[model samples]
Target chain A: MARVVVDVMPKPEILDPQGQAVARALPRLGFSGVGEVRQGRHFELDVDDTVDDETLAKIAEGFLANPVIEQWTIRRVDA
Target chain B: MARVVVDVMPKPEILDPQGQAVARALPRLGFSGVGEVRQGRHFELDVDDTVDDETLAKIAEGFLANPVIEQWTIRRVDA
Candidate 1:
């Protein structure tokens, strides 16, 4: 079995309320030096060796992420 | 400004319904080679040079992630 890691993030132009919430909370928590905080999704998959990069990309875009607002990248993780 | 990326993942013993949903959907989507799927949260923060590793970890645990079930790691991203 092979392991793959996928990272899904919002487009730079998109507004991320969750991130903003965290950013705002940071100052209250005494970490006033922190700036923008963007939140995203990370996925780890265990797959058969037959799964190729293209297939992984397809899965990431078609199933794991919203292609319209989010972009994802897949990388093979050493087992 | 320095960039830092934080990855928050569910503990290995915890149940991940979101990941399971994705795994189940994969077969229906014709990507049957996939196995276990685990979902996590990723955060990217822009911080001043004054922010140290310990502070980053604190932010990640206290605000960005739930330290109980989710474990997070922080890394500096190249500009």
Candidate 2:
């Protein structure tokens, strides 16, 4: 099987309330000397090796991600 | 600066409808020899090296992820 990964982070220009909220909360929670936590999501996938490149590319573009809000990269995890 | 990564996958027990739909769509999109596309996200960050481990750990758990629905890992994106 080939492994796939995708990540989605907030647009840089967009207000990242979650990241800001976390930044504000961290100090209160006893985490010192840390600031500006930008938050995002990550994914891991196991795909059958028989899957070819074109289809996986389609999957990444059409279904796996919303391009307006996020950017993604795909790679086969080497054995 | 240290780079942080987090990945979250749908629980295996839960149905991945997005994956199933992508699996179905790929063939229609003219990609052959493909099946079962599981999708997820990836993240890249440039974190200050002076930030200690404990704080980053807390960021991973408290802010970067929603542990109930996702699982995550963190590593320094080595220079």
Candidate 3:
């Protein structure tokens, strides 16, 4: 089996409350010098070796993520 | 400024409903032959140049992820 990783992040313009909450909490937790934080989704897939990059991209774009609000990248990882 | 990515994923033994939902949805959306899907969190951190890997990992462990049920990896990315 081939391992695939998909990183999906919201468009820069979108407001991410979950990220903001983490950013705000960091300072309270004594983590200083931290900058902006944006949160998104990460997906790991175990697929057949026959799956190609093109097919993975289609899966990421068509099902794993919503193209309208987020952008995703697909990469193959060692199993 | 430096860009850092923290990938947080649920422990393998944990149940991931969100991932299962996606896996189920994929076939309905016409994407077939996909295997198990695991979902997690993706975080992008913009930090000062002086921030070292140790500090980044600390932030990921102390603030971004829950060590008990999830595991996280920290890496630097191109700006």
Candidate 4:
């Protein structure tokens, strides 16, 4: 088995309200010198060892994510 | 500076509709043997060198994430 890690984030031009809110609230959380906060999601997916690159790309685009608002990268790691 | 990695995932019992959807769609995307898709998010935050573990824990809880539906962990890495 192979492990795939997917990190998904909002497109740069798109406004991220959650990230903005986090940035604004961090200081109040007691870190007086903190700067920006960019929020995103990380997924650990277990892919079959035999999967190919092209098929993985299609999985990423089709249902693995929402391409309009998010970008994802997959890295294969030891199972 | 130090780097912090945060991985946010829906609590195990909480329904991850998006992840479930992805799991179902993978087979159609030509990954015939794909099993599950538990999607989450990852973020890398640069922390100042002076930060202590206690303050970092506050940052992880208060503003760095949503405690109700999400859980996050931070790791210090070289900047």
Question: Best candidate per lDDT, number?
Answer: 1
TM-score to native of every candidate shown: 0.96, 0.68, 0.92, 0.79
**Candidate 2 per-residue lDDT over residues B1-79, each given as its tens digit:** 5665655456666677776776677677766555455554444555677877776777767766667766666776673
Q: For residues B1-79, write the lDDT of model 3, one tens digit per residue.
A: 9888999999999899999998888879877777899999999989888888887888888888889999988888997
Pairs with steric clashes in candidate 2: A6-B41, A6-B42, A7-B41, A7-B42, A42-B8, A42-B41, A43-B41
Docking class of 2: acceptable
Residue A19 lDDT (model 1): 93
Instruction: Provide the global lDDT of candidate 4 against the true structure.
Output: 0.73
lDDT tens string, model 4, A1-79? Answer: 6777778778877787877777677776656655556677777677787877777777776765689998878777786
Question: Which one wins on DockQ?
Answer: 1
The residue ranges of model 1 lying beyond 4 angstroms of the native Cα positions read none
In terms of lDDT, the poorest run of 10 residues in model 1 chain B is B58-67
lDDT tens readout by residue for model 1, A42-69: 9999999999888988888888889899
Measured over the true interface residues after superposition, the C-alpha RMSD of each candidate is 0.7, 3.6, 1.2, 1.8
lDDT per residue, candidate 1, B1-79, as tens digits?
Answer: 8999999999999999999999998888788799999999988899999999998888888887887898888999874
TM-score between candidate 1 and the true structure: 0.96
Docking level for model 1: high
Evaluate fnat for each of the predicted models and list the values in order.
0.97, 0.42, 0.90, 0.63
lDDT of each: 0.90, 0.64, 0.88, 0.73
Ranking by lDDT: 1, 3, 4, 2
Please give the lDDT score at residue B5 for candidate 2. Answer: 61
